[model samples]
Target: MSNAKRALQTEDLTKIEVFSDPQLSPDGNFYSYVSTKANDKDDYNSQLFVQSLNGDTPVQWTFGDVKNSNLRYSPDGKKAVFQSTRSGLPQLWLLPTEGGEARQLTTFKNGASNPTWSKDGKFIFFHASLDKDDDIQNQKEASKEERQKEQEDKKKQPLIVNRLKYKSDSSGFHDNKRVQLISLNLESNTFTQLTNNDADHGFQDVSPDGKQVLFAANLNENADYELSNDLFLLDLQSKEYKKLTDGNGGYHSASFSPSGDKVVSFGDEYEYAGATLTEIYVFDLASGERTCLSKSWDMQLGDLMIGDTRMGQSETGPVWSKDESSLFFIATDYGATGLYKVSLNKELTTLYKEDNHVFGFSYDQDKEAFVLGISSATNPCDFYYLKNDGTLTKLTKSNDAFLNEVAIAEPETLSVKAEDGKEIQGWLLKPYGFTEGKKYPFVLEIHGGPHAMYGQTFFFEMQLLAAKGYVVLYTNPRGSHGYGQEFVDACRSDYGGGDYKDLMTAVDYVLENYSFIDEDRLGVTGGSYGGFMTNWIVGHTNRFKAAVTQRSISNWLSFYGVSDIGFFFNKWEHGLNLLDDPAKLWEISPLRYAENVETPLLILHGELDFRCPVEQGEQLFITLKHLRKEVEFVRFPGANHELSRSGKPAMRQERLNHICRWFEEYL
Candidate 1:
């Protein structure tokens, strides 16, 4: 392996291409997907591609440097509409399936994305942020002079906030704009706004008969404080809407049945807030009753956990069976994300179980087949056709050129009992050029979200660390998904408690079994929640020689007001609001124990990170520096919380350099 090709480097990320957003055509004869690759400028670019059902190389349907995504074929299957950034702002673009030059469709000033086709193909539905009082005419034909005036006006005006949530981690300051669901009449060349709410309305699926459109919206009075949304159906003719969900839980992934009489929903009752396991539900349109189909399945549905390497946007569809007897959806179980089949009568079946990640899939009802976007630890992701009998046929190799040039280390999956005897799952990646008996440095990699799981998905950061001759260890601790509801809710209100112990136990088990690990040369690093744990670990114990925390929380008290979700997330995870108990928030915070930290710590954060906020890192850095503890802080200027995963290429490479340098120097 060593002589065949070199190991992966930080810059190799540019060569790593990804394919996602698999969409089945109306005739079940073609499957469309999005492919992303680095442009000559080193910035990432995505394009749309389609392949025939008879196993052929996918035809690149769209071209140019700009990104083209959110693809959906028309009802006639002759044309496709997608979102692209070719117009400076992401707008709708139309392309012919037969092949031709793609043409621009919508030219909205705020941009249009996530395009969905109406059953009749007369109109296309999409989501876009529009000014509160602005309509279709106000956006498209706006003069360039007017836009220039608005930009100058913004420069001369003061920034204002009028809503409970004014900014988010994904998009910066949310002005007076609201993301609403709208329909574009292809024939009339006019736009119809279906939703007029202050909150965001995400379009899900349209009815088979094209009478209604299904969508999810958190229409509560205080949606910012509550983690709940209701499934609603909009009348296409009358332009009226009716709520389906009780607005108790955060229901999402709502899709109509083939008969259009019911909708299959994927979400939880918020039994454990954000950590609650996702369940499949069937809501009858006529009776207005919802049935929980996977109440007893005990596994989380869909991919909630995150990895450092995953690219491309994949569609989430709870596709109805041709006969409408069952619903198929994605399930994150253990180390694999696979397709799950659940019947209306509560019967459950593992449709496509594999030790890999099923990021997305498209069902071909007529052909009784599916095109799944699947990948393993060694593969990024590609389209695979799954026949009715459960056989998989590879469709694309977007990353083959890069993967073939670099050797990837497959980690050894291991299971061990935690401090409480509850089993924990983890993996250990040996350093490149590893020897049987040579001792080597080990780094315990913690994942963020404490709720997010680490499993079969490929992680670029972990592989890069392994390539640099550092054994990388990552595990799904107590609060991680893929496990049951109880296991996921274990870490709530007990942050840095059982979850921390489970991680420490995972490390102890690896060290004891893997005799080649140098116990004293141990190091730890994590981002977000993992960052919180790294901070907690250093403060509580000095076992590790060095630590790096990225976009982590240092003090919950201040975090409650700064982070984008800080206001409500604290209440959900810790069961304590700022007014309820400020002391407990600080008690669990790593900043409270800042004086106890002695490990040489390196802090990495994005200045624009409103999730954990750079302030969280600032407090920790200042506190440790004043205490005379060895520490350094590196902040990225225009980056966000997702810097490590999808930030600028240059910044990502520099981040990796800082991480390697800190670990190399201290450990």
Candidate 2:
């Protein structure tokens, strides 16, 4: 037996380092970023680190095993601020750029987060959840003893749900408190509330003159049923505000141009709501004109790229260049995330394009350079600088040791035409140590977010499957981003139709092209929407020998009442409602066809997943048992819908092990 470098092990997940939130200093001489790693507690911990752009060694700024993140630089570059949990709750902490002890800034009950420096650097703006009547000064004046008593005196009672959205998968049950925008004056050490109302304020960019702030909020009297998050600009001194958006759909990530005459952001009109693609929009402040800047540029804007790394940054921007003639943002295109530059003239350019995923990026104004976190199928994320000369330079090597130790399979991009003659984007991964003449088992891996794109990024689970001698095929079928909006919305209200055909066509394309792939010994697995697809696939066809479905939706009718977004999502995606068309929900549900399933199936779910609640899995498991179908169920305790991506280290490892063991026993 020839010994190849060891295949990536599920246990190696503990060694993966996730680098995110790269912030450039005002002088563009140094960059501060956060790196998270698995700790002895079987959980992830994060710390801050900074490195000079001039080839200086990186220095670890914060110590301890706690999570420290959201690092931001002040305008003058004299000091920085971040959020930390060293005090038991996340609070603002300030550290001098010249090196000194970090000092605590705000001590609030809900804690301060998303802190940004004011233009003059005289104050900091942040957002925090507060009771409608809670006063900031009152909490600051209370003694430590009083704080302890207040905490102990509070009673633990049953949750009373009143709002249509009472619980979230991440925050659990809600307190009915609103998230308000806040500003803290550094010189006076005083706190001022910027927003006070029933609706939650989605923070956006602060004006250049520091006299006004922009944000998105749905302040309508009937916010629960409303679908619009209008953009607003609030004057700091006058306490007056004006609405910018016309309130058609949801808007987010609004950033001011350098001239402050226009604001650039991304949002959707919600004409398709669930299936609608997010587009870039520019709102002119002087003319009160709101234009869909990306209306013609159909590829979804912002990050829809998914990978196995934990605690990655969200896709947000339209950050204006120093001249304000152009905006740089993240766009999902052709199965990868790339940094794109769009001019006010509507000419687009791919400043940095490659078969890699860029989860975060920030432009350095002083140096006129860009700092990006890019990674490929075999590489974890690390910082890279796109120089003024259009050259790329690696900035960090956080995963070099683990990368050098493991043998990961590199994916080959494949394109196949669907029945409708539309091209489907896909990738084929040969088994690790693949021999040209050897026939090996293959797995069809499906991605979630019928809207989320499967791109060139390191997915540990796919690598693990390849290491175990299974060639894997994954794709961005219809209803996936990175493609044109028409291609993405084509799968809406037709979940089991064209999208299913697209996957089958991709499998057929690989089978016809790759002779080494074992056609008779095939396996399939996916989570979330992919989980729903797996369930739908098994019930509709028996081609695969085995399958694993995770956190899936089985019955749309039951989902309508149970899942977090079921009430509206069912209508928006399937064009069906429980009250209006019960038959339609059952017609599209995978559980409706469970009797046809012949593949040995494994079901996985998170117990605390409020998005696609565990009951979805329990129902399918019971139905399969009643039918005496070959099936097994595994439930992860204290895990949410993000179990595969950001769950506990042990749980995520077990999930991978379960999938591998199931396919090994059956395939």
Relative to the unseen true structure, what is the C-alpha lDDT of residue 380 in candidate 1, on a scale of 0 to 100? 82
- What's the CA RMSD of model 2 in angstroms? 2.2
Assess the local accuracy of residue 266 in candidate 1 as a C-alpha lDDT between 0 and 100.
82
lDDT tens readout by residue for model 1, 139-221: 77345687788879888988887777889999887787788988889898888888889888989988988889989999888
Per-residue lDDT value at 223 in model 1: 84
Give the alpha-carbon lDDT of every model.
0.86, 0.88
Across 1-667, the per-residue lDDT of candidate 2 in tens digits comes to: 1235788898899998888888888888888888898999987788999999875778999988788999888999999989997776678999998999999998888778889888899989998888989898655434557767865665455567788877778887677689999998999998999999898998898999998999889988888887789999999999898988877788888988877889988888887776677888898999988776677877788888877784745334788888888888888888888888888878898888898998888788757788888889989888898986798999888888888888878889999999999999899888878887999998999999888889899899998998898999999899998888788888899999999999999999999999998899999999989999999999998999999999998999999989888988888888877988999889989999999999999999999999999999999999999999999999999999999999999999999999999999998
User: Worst 10-residue stretch by lDDT in candidate 2?
Assistant: 138-147
Assess candidate 2 and give its TM-score to the true structure.
0.97
Backbone collisions counted per model? 0, 0
- RMSD per model, one decimal: 1.7, 2.2
**Per-candidate TM vs. native?**
0.97, 0.97
Candidate 1: residue pairs that collide: none
User: After superposing candidate 1, which stretches have Cα over 4 Å from the reference?
Assistant: 1-3, 141-155
